[model samples]
Target: MIDWLHPSVLLMLGMLPLIWLRGRARQIWQVTLPAIILGLITTLAAGSQLSLSFMGLELTPLRVDKLSLVFAYVIGIILIIGNIFALQVEDRAQHIAAGLYGASALGVVLAGDLVTLYVFWEIMMIASVWLIWRRKTPIAYEAGMRYLLVHALGGMLLFVGVIGYYLATGSVAFEKIDVDGWAFWLILIAFLINAAVPPLHAWLPDAYPEATVTGTVFLSALTTKTAVYTLMRGYPGLELLLWLGVAMTLYGVIYATLINDIRRLLSYHIISQVGYMVAGVGMGTALALNGTAAHAFTHILYKALLLMGAGAVLQMTGRSRMSDLGGLYRYMPMTFLLYMVGALSISAFPLFSGFVSKTMIVEAAAVDYRGVVYLLMLLAACGTFLSTGLKLPYFTFFGKDSGLRPKEPPINMQIAMGIAAALCFLIGIFPGALYAILPFPVDYNAYTLSHLLKELQLLFFVGLGFVVVIRYAGGKDYIALDVDWLYRGPGRRLVIHTRNMIAEANHDVRAEFMRFLAKLQTRLGKAHLDGSLLRTWATGSMALWTALVLALVLVLTLGT
Candidate 1:
């Protein structure tokens, strides 16, 4: 019903035909041009909004605010970058899925009402699974199915929560509300699931590495960040989030440390990155909220950059397991450089994007007097430095030489990495550009002497620890147990066992019935052979036969 909502609708419709665009050039334009136009429109009229009413429900399809604008900007920008990264891909399905997936994310942030938000939420879920599925390997197919199954469960939770909310309050607008009962908690669980908060998080690390190279980039950037945006919008200051966020940070680092595959390790690292943002939302101060928004923006860029670098290695060498890869720095030095930028940024090294943004949240936790929480956040930061910043890059690019040579990836791919790498530095050096657009005003300085020295010392010690233990710190190629083991391991065995028991019981019942039938047939044949069935009714004989027949009927009817 919103007039300017027309552009988003039209853009999404435009993507449908991309499924048939087989030519590489057409794919590029199809994926990138609409994103460019949408980005332009968003910048030019960043404050525009439109709303409509139907059946006593209010809907705002193109709501624009500072929070929505930041999320919209990233998804729009990433669309172009992601497609450029995927430019040489002949798979039209990836292009279509990426376009619609980006559209749904943009729609989610812009939607001012629950109806609009939930509709797009479901669309986003369905579209993303295709990206994994289109990888077209057995692993990809199975991972995609599991991914779908999990999100579908989340969607059902959201559906129930939304309906219960509207029924309880007679309002369906997507705004902050008191957690009165089942409605709020149900919806919260759904968001946490999407955000990859701990027990619910296995789906992300499980499925992302299985996606197409470019698809994983989009996957890493969009879904979890959308949850961050929504949580900031609707659930800031919720106390429970503090514990959940910290748990994710620590849990992710532990798994990421033990993970062997490069992309899979990075996938686990995402839970750590998102933890900072979620904890920021929980802190509920202006500084913390602003930091969450800033981190989300910067995280998207660097995380995508990391994935792009990993994808480059995967593409060139056809190997992603670090044990099978090394010494590629000599062959693909540009990749090494771009990848290190991402690593440094994510590690929150001084003067990189992450240091500038992530410091704000840790500061917020301190200012709020959440000292224990602050300590945990600090510990998680150290773990991040150990795993992502040190171990991943070392094993992939600089560690043991596996004697495999791989060239730099395609120009478009390199350009994508370069652009992302540039933004990581750009935001770090010029924090004001990112700060200016935050929903809250920013006054924090990240580069003051104490802050810089503190961050450097932390990184230094973590790096030293890694160096001292390098001989014993190699990645093991064994699966690390996680919450998914319940379903995929023991839970699966339980279901199969229950099914087998039921099958065995059914077989026994059938066998008993067949045996009874066989016995009856044998008795009838014997009776016929002896001609007892043609008994003459002599008085005593008839009386005795009738008495036997009555007893048999009684046994069959009651005694048995």
Candidate 2:
């Protein structure tokens, strides 16, 4: 069964080229059909494993444990929904790239060995960049290049680390690991870069918002969450992740609050949101890891829904800045309502998906006596509401009429958002359905009098602050720098200065050597006139020496 399913899915990868065929129906089916087949393979492959030996290394191309299954299930669903959302896109390359990107994402999670994971990881990075480049904007192209460079750096780290680990352990299994040495640190840094952890995080916001609208939806779903999945498998309960996660949570919130463009705002929010999952991995408790997986599941759904909503407005109005959008609910009521569902869900409103999964991390923090971490997570929740929930929505949907009336997006887009919004709500109200596929058993409940009251009060106060933030915050479309400043600013200047200095030094050394060679040539050119005895009587002396040698040989023969 595993043998047939794995090859069948790989065969589906070949069908992406069919999207280049004429007719809208053919293109949509080209991508969607493959997505449906992969989904079916995921469902049918429960408790299955596929193994092979290549170059003396054992490989697990397909592993269907609970953890891998849950991720695969979500990946399959996202591919279909993302394809459906992209149905109206006529760019065949976008469709084909998105399809291949999804295939690689599924392979990444299902991989049971480091070699398999690395192959899929590289494919994923390569395939997703086309989505950004397909947009064909100066910003998108430049952003795509930066995105490739960052992920390439991460890939190099991961590759070297994998080689070193195999040398040390003599195995290639993908499982839990410790902070052994440079190899482990290299691998960990690679995962952290993908997870969008601070300092290594700027690539996400730099590149994600630059993708084509339909492409951004798929972009939001795949890469970073795949990193989270790898982290769960490789480095669970590593204590440093706790503070790193906390910093990411706050770092994203602060920057997101200041950002004006809707997509960029949400891009920073990705950094913030993934911080929760990273924090969960840090705690490394069964509950925390379960929550990490579950939250990643929900974040993908609601975040896609939110992006779909934003993309709808941008698609219709030709603008995405909050400063340029207002009172849109008058025309795009369906978009407004659908977008709100995502906003509420991400803000962790009661009976929403975030409410159910986000607290699992906080609860883990609390139980583990991480009081400081608990407070920071709570503040991040408030900031989540203030920025994404209240600020983004108010200015876009209801703050003030911007005098631009545009109709709703296409039906396919609405259907896509509806599917995603439905999943967000369904998982929130009934987390057990989502929990069932988790790697471990879950018995915790999210609703209690104290927990409910605290969440409400926290959001309520944040809502009040939003009233003030709107009056002053996000009123301008200005850029604010983050950790990216180190490289994009002083670090870039330093590189240029260092190159110039090396070039100048090379010029000096070459000139000095040329001068020395000229002097040596001058001395050799004058050697004939340097007053040597051989120069005075060269011809006469040569003949006399030859005659004397002959005469001496004759006299010696006579004496003998």
Candidate 3:
């Protein structure tokens, strides 16, 4: 019974006071309070493991295994760093929401049963919406509502799948179910939406950029990563993920390349990175899953780092569009350096975390899937380099210097970016530490002649393609469409049409009702006061009443 209380729950419960004290404390303390609670939860969860059963059902509510540990640890670290990044802000509501958001994510990763996972999953959705709402703009509000609706839809699908699974299999364990039926497919669809799989991925770019700068960092780290964790946990061997992953990879890269907004480009790249992890998970080999896990861990660090750098720029310049931001490298040297490290790491350059982690997934694809899957992944890798690795940093920091001379970000923001950048390099330089936490043993070396040559060839050719595109048609006046176009274009029109129809119908109904009432009043007035109808009715009623009384007496006697 005591074991079921789990250390994470206890730590979160402990945060209640600090959250209540948020109003009275300094901004730093308010942010740090959640960080402290998260750190304590991570520390306490380190070695403890327990499970229980109730009502004839086995309940593993707290499973601190390797896979869970890695994510829990990364999420905790990110939360603390995110706190530091957001420390200067004085919004107590954002502080509390961010704290609960991190706590809920931690709970989701650590949960051992489907029921518990679902509970935490919903909590994460609710808490994260608050982060977006913290932006406090009308656009942010609209984005948040859309984000909420999408996640609620996801929650509904997941709940239905859970119910079906329980009915079909009579168990609510979080383990993988057979992907042979509606239940499993429902669950997969739910996860796909959360993973920001294409067509359904607009919620990310729409919402994340709308968040306050600090809020975007935390937002970037948790939701999708939690989805990745669930994927690794529940659907590791699902083959459809391989192709779905490829689709997501290419979709993200193309859109990212076309995006003029800096943060939107990063948001697109998030989908791109998740695609790699998804591909790895789809491969389902020990090395592939390990790569998936490691990539996700490294990605959270680097992606958050990237967003932090962007956030710093936004904080200093109040601009997020790449066209509007450039050449700040002169004033923000430290941020530029940190941003470069993140970009390099993401590019999978030698001696970076991405090189160590992302390769395993690619290698697995090359070996296991072979043929088109491998080729597509290779192409996507190049796309990754073009869109994010080179494109993001080049345009923002080094491109033609947009003549903007903004001051460096606040000291704490720089520190946050620095921490993330350092970790990116450290992990790349030494892969063994990250590898040790992987769910499976890793035997592949990242730096081989064949691998390096192949990667360079792919990247170089892809770079040339980007150059050609830029020279030939990159500036052409054309809009690349996304699934959001359906809603933004057709769906929106349908809504407008429906509203107009309803308004017309309502107006007609109101007019008809008014006319009918008017006619009834006129009739009543005429009958009662302006005609002989009332007098004739009174005389007729008296004759009819006398006849009815005689008829009733006769019938009563006969019946008796």
Query: Which regions of candidate 3 are displaced past 4 Å?
Result: 1-59, 456-480, 503-560
- Superior by TM-score: candidate 2 or candidate 3: 2
Per-prediction TM-score to the true structure, in the order listed: 0.88, 0.88, 0.86
TM-score-sorted candidate list, best first: 1, 2, 3
Decide which is better by lDDT, 1 or 3. 1
Compose the digit string of candidate 2's lDDT tens values, residues 223-325.
9999999999999998899889999999999999889899999999999999999999988999999989998999999999999899999999999998999
Clashing pairs in 1: none
Q: How many clashes in each candidate?
A: 0, 0, 2
lDDT of each: 0.87, 0.87, 0.81
TM-score of 1: 0.88
- Per-residue lDDT tens digits of candidate 3, residues 1-560? 23455545654565566655643365556556556655555554444656677787666777777888888878878987898888788776787777778878888888887777888889889989999998999989988998998899999999999888888888888877664689898888888888998877888977898898999998999999999999999988788887778788888887887887677788888999899988877888998899999999999999999899888988898888776766788888898899888887887877888888988888888777477887787777777888776666666777667788988888888888888988999998888899987887789888889877876777777678766765341212234566766766898899999999999999999999989977876888877766444334676888899899999999999999
- Which portions of model 2 miss their true places by more than 4 Å? 1-3, 7-14, 44-46, 497-560
- Return model 1's CA RMSD, one decimal: 9.2
